[model samples]
Target: MPSEEHTGKSQPPVRSQPFPLEFPGVHYFDEQEIEAVKRVLRARSPFRYYGVDLQGEAEAFEREFAAFVGAKHAVAVGSGTGALSVALAALGVGPGQEVIVPAYLWVSVVAAVVNQGAIPVLADIDDTFGLNPASVQARISSHTTGIILVHMSGAPADAPALAELARQHGLWLLEDCAQCAGGSIHGRKVGTFGDMGIFSFQMNKNMTAGEGGCVVTSDDRLAQRAEACHDLGYARDRNGRLIFDSPELCLWGKGTRLDELRAAILRVQLRKLPVVTAAMRRSKYRIRQALEAFPQVALRRIQDPDGDTGCFLITTYPDAETARRVNLALRAEGIVTYPQGISNVLMTDWGLHLYYNIPSLVHRTSIDRAGFPWNLTENRGLGGNYAKGACPAADSLFERSIVLAIPSCLTRSDEDDIIRAFEKVLREHLSS
Candidate 1:
């Protein structure tokens, strides 16, 4: 048995072999997660929580989570979407305002902006799959209120530059950590770079409570606003009473409270986060080593100045046909791969077309005029979206990219299986 210390630093030598046979599905949860849920069920009050009961756990979690993210404060919320909604509301974003977001992202991100009566200005992603600050700068109108930078798949956005851009332009920043919860850049956490950072604890996340999320900030006033907005616009009075029935409460409020049960589960999960993060890094290296020498497939690109990477493995292809073949091939071999297809509620989706009424950009339009361009490795015979004419670069990645699950609990043998499975898929596909 390899101890954490031994396995932690062991980076396998680069090689190409038929990936090994490993079971396909993920083992995301464990006894520790189960016990945490059990503790929540055993709590004194459980679900029927009040102001202080919820706030107390929130405060504690906020402190711990803030420390984890290297921020001054955090505010736990019901979901990652709720965190965005409340954070925007707390920042006073409303009708007649505009918010900038990447075109390629989880639908909830754009939904949060639109739901708040604000218009979403879509910007194209850069080579790293994050918001292009240049595109952001080009899209800024007088009505622009904020920028929601989603650090997609734990790849940190160009934080320092983006932060400076936001500050220079006097725009609010909301870091979306739905996928990259524990990711950091240059020895700093992802979410803490913006005005208010949001995190999701959805079942599939690196750290999860089945379904919960949080927001973090360094500003005291922002923290108070988040609490008030999440709790029907009620803040505690000096006498420990909710300061509702006041002129302020009448002005702003919403009910998106976090109950005690989720908090209890989260507390235990927080205790396990450090260990989980370490294992995730190790597992990522395992896959990276196997894929390093393969020219037929391109592994997901990650740039970490500190030599760290996210837990999951993402591989991009050149076109949708290749992506489909690779995905089908992997699935047939009992190894699952998630293609980076457009979200269900994208602009072209049937329902979204009617809801947002988004129009297609004109031919040769300046969509990528100010954005950085990036293309995935082309040899994989995967990538371009067969439907959307050609974004050869974006299409290639989205059409053929693969997402493999790597939970923190995987054993060394399991890790080896994952590496081998990927190599097997690539080698077979390449030879064919």
Candidate 2:
């Protein structure tokens, strides 16, 4: 059997007969990245703690990223989850409040809400694999205080609709742009449309610095709150200079500031993001055009065709059974696809952890052992059941969907192999 390394790095040359195409690895670090890291080390004083240097790589990164996203301020944090938690906390989402989140997203989204002592009401997603505005409206309750819209798989969600919904309900809109750094909607960036937007620079994200995140916002108060929350409630003046002597601390803040080392590395990655995202977009377009012959397969809906970051290519089959069969066939052909069902022990027992399945959240016995947030006196009668069919759209979507990770570094031949594999599989399946 070919090892994972061989499959991802060096597969046999493309041939008439189908051969596995090497998956594009993470962005390669060259002299620029090396120099950035070296410069940080040479400085030896990358700390952002109180009373330390203020102008550093982290600050520079915040400025560059904020400018890139067209936001007035950006607060650098330790990770994407940290950014979410800080943003929620800064926005005043607290105990007894409900924050609507998409059911089909990384578990961290749920965890961030949990960490903030707020309830995460799971909402279903439409074909875009993002929070369905209708589902979001349905999930909104008297207790609902905010909505976290995830741009899943780097495809921009219906931001205009979601934004209007937030306005109508007076709910805070937090855009989770973890998978969509360069993604835009109608020429506007994804992270700039909400009250506050958060981005991830984790290893797998479109723009990465090993592991980091930032919160961007045009709202001055929200930005200051996020910054203070990220740095242990350190008060900041109007100019965002840290104020050490403020008597009032708004909330219990966590120390989740981004360090200088990673920030330095991110500076280099940020410069390369546009080029990488463009390549991924071109790869997606080529694959989509190639698959047009197969009417049985449909690409995931894009709310805005021109706004996709092209980090992932998701398709749906005619039905669940056919989707499962094609998934298996594609794997046999060494083309990776989203796994079907609970295939292993981890997935079987704890698969819900991947997205913190709503049912698990409602009946969280172990984590809520103290009965604090889930069953607290303040939250009594607030907790509800997340039954198996709670989110029908999201449930059905995952079953019939096959997600292919589109690497930014895909070569022309690699893209060709991916297209040919899909065509070959669909031809055989349709013919049979």
Candidate 3:
């Protein structure tokens, strides 16, 4: 706690109880979800493709999710990481190629690229906390094959500009919508903006089934490739048998199939997603409006405010130290910034999500001692600097920005408690 002498103002009133920090989708579970899971279990058909009494929950979820996101097709995967690898393999991002990714992203993003035998080139993030188009352009080379545009937090990235860039360079655009599953830009859902897009229903997402995700695409051939890559390295006939006629078009499977039990829960969660996002958005907007009087703190730039999932609120201070002080004050006030992964909330903690802190990527460690991916025969001369100052803009941004998650369920008092803390803390630390 900062002493009154250090702060130049008396400490504000603190909450008597700890804030209710919770997982979003979990809050909305009820009898509907319980009955859905029971139906799957009772049928004894836990698998989606085949069983004694196949419930078709997985197939139904995929079809509904694809339609909701405005995509022609969707393939359910075991997890978000599974979806990422499937999308990369579908795009042929392997051996000697590079994929441009934002420095502020999930660690699994790089893992997906490396698993495909491709390299991940870190790019800076702008005020949007999304990929910087200029940085991506500067890094593109003959070895570059695609751009993985991540909708960081709850908001959509600048997909139109990135899509145009991809078209001009003839590179595939893969949208990482794990953070922004129901997000959109001007009413066009996020997952449909790229040639291939993926969403996570992990426990922490806007909607969840504990561990599940899906890949969506409008391209017929790309959809086929993703299906084959996620299943058995071959296409299945209508009667559920593998067909070997299209050997040239076949992709090696990673066996990332989604099961019937998870699919049933996800189906219920999907129906409740709009409501989940709406509640969070309402609370977040109200909080931001109340905090606007403090000019020292700026809100994150959302391309479409209404389209955001509204789970995370990013507030930026002028410098690193001030950001640190304000965050400490908030915690002292009994406010939980982000509970799922505390490291991601303030961007203060390292060795978690930041690009430079990734030991394997920064040190260029590969599966083999000879540096298989980095030192592969086709990867000669392809390199990147993953040192501390590689992405200068993003490095500073992380230090200055503090993210807070808006719970799926919040009462009026809950909202007021947040605003009260911001009002008290910002006035003391941010007042000129």
Candidate 4:
């Protein structure tokens, strides 16, 4: 049991642990990262120069990351959302088209699809918090151009199944690996399972570069398109040098470029990813083992436990009411729970309030008040209403689920304490 000395006034009156287990900060920088940034600063020339043939930090990081993920080509971009938008454009997703995405993901996923002048159709998720293949199949229409399969919270979705479905329908498959860096399924990494994959190096992600992203693909044409689309559609040669004489430009291209400073920091962070993911996996396993005795507490469905990056531990309760009670009990014991959203946007206990459910996309037919996309009579019929029962499975799961952010740097003692806290709370609930 935790001692009373650990209790704080803000926390409820319960046995307090010495360390209040809070979610780990996103920016976990070390001396190496600081030194890497300094080195880039010292170079003074951070901009990627064309026709130089010399590998800059961004290009070098791209090559290293490509090799690490077993991809033939890697294109670094400004951010994960930018990576997705560029990849979608590369895959030819444009107006009057649709892209299927899981309902449980961050708003950025939907935003990326909408930004392409396409309709984002929200699909239901399975117990793994990933897009259900059957749901995806059902959601696909004649206008559906692609599917964005997200590996939610470092857990690999049924990529093999999703891949087969995409192939059968002849739809482009894009892996949203924003949260699942260093994660794999079977023996293959999550990003490689799709035609093209995007990764985020955001501060809160498993890997960090403050704000950066990458698109990896083995397809030559797709790689070229992504490269061109990321840099305002500037024509580049085989060596990624700009062709100033080219009259061609990507219509959907944006100036989303990854700088050398972030690229340098990412290089150092990339090398340490395996070690960090391993530690997280160990901590999650320890916590899962401790909670195994409680039948009412179900661990999140993981397709490959060994392959999981273990960035988050999600448990489901028997019912939504039961989950609510446990949430209060845990908080009373000074245990932290996952926030509904960033800042102060509180999500409903049933999880009905979601990014897709916002009136702009759901109730209103047009993306903008001017009704540009929806006003096109051809597109009006394509847009679907995202009502309360839009994704029942995801809503139920969110209501019953308690997500815990697993830190990459946890000691054995810290893991043990976490296990103890969970066990204490579950036992109390079960007895009651």
Winning candidate number (lDDT): 3
RMSD (Cα, Å) of model 4: 3.9
Worst 10 residues of 1 by lDDT: 371-380
Worst 10 residues of 3 by lDDT: 336-345
Q: Name the lDDT value of residue 403 in candidate 4.
A: 72
Q: Mind giving the per-residue lDDT tens digits that candidate 4 earns over 297-365?
A: 878889989889988888888887777766665555645423432211112432322644555656644
Q: Candidate 1: list runs displaced more than 4 Å.
A: 1-43, 47-55, 238-240, 244-251, 305-309, 337-393
Q: Tens digit of lDDT per residue, candidate 2, span 39-66?
A: 8777665764422434478888999999
**lDDT of each candidate versus the true structure:** 0.63, 0.75, 0.87, 0.77
Query: What pairs collide in candidate 4?
Result: none
Better of 1 and 4 by TM-score: 4
Report the candidate with higher lDDT, 1 versus 3.
Answer: 3
List candidate 2 segments past 4 Å from native. Answer: 1-25, 49-55, 236-244, 247-250, 337-362, 365-368
Order by TM-score, highest first:
3, 4, 2, 1
Model 1, position 96, has a per-residue lDDT of 65
Model 1 CA lDDT for position 428: 54
- Candidate 3's residue-wise lDDT over 1-432, tens digit each? 324454455554455455555578999999999999999999999988888899899999999999999999999999999999999988888998989998888888999998888888988989999998999999899999999999988899899999999999999999999989889989999988789999998988999989999999999998999999999888888666788899755669989999999999999999999999999899989998997888878888888889988888889999999999888777766676333435225675634468887888889889887887898998887759987799999899889988887888888898898899888888778859
* Candidate 1 local distance difference test against the native: 0.63
Cα deviation at 333, candidate 2, in Å, is 1.4
Give RMSD to native, each candidate.
Answer: 10.8, 4.9, 2.2, 3.9
* 367: Cα error in model 1, Å: 28
Question: What RMSD value applies to candidate 3?
Answer: 2.2
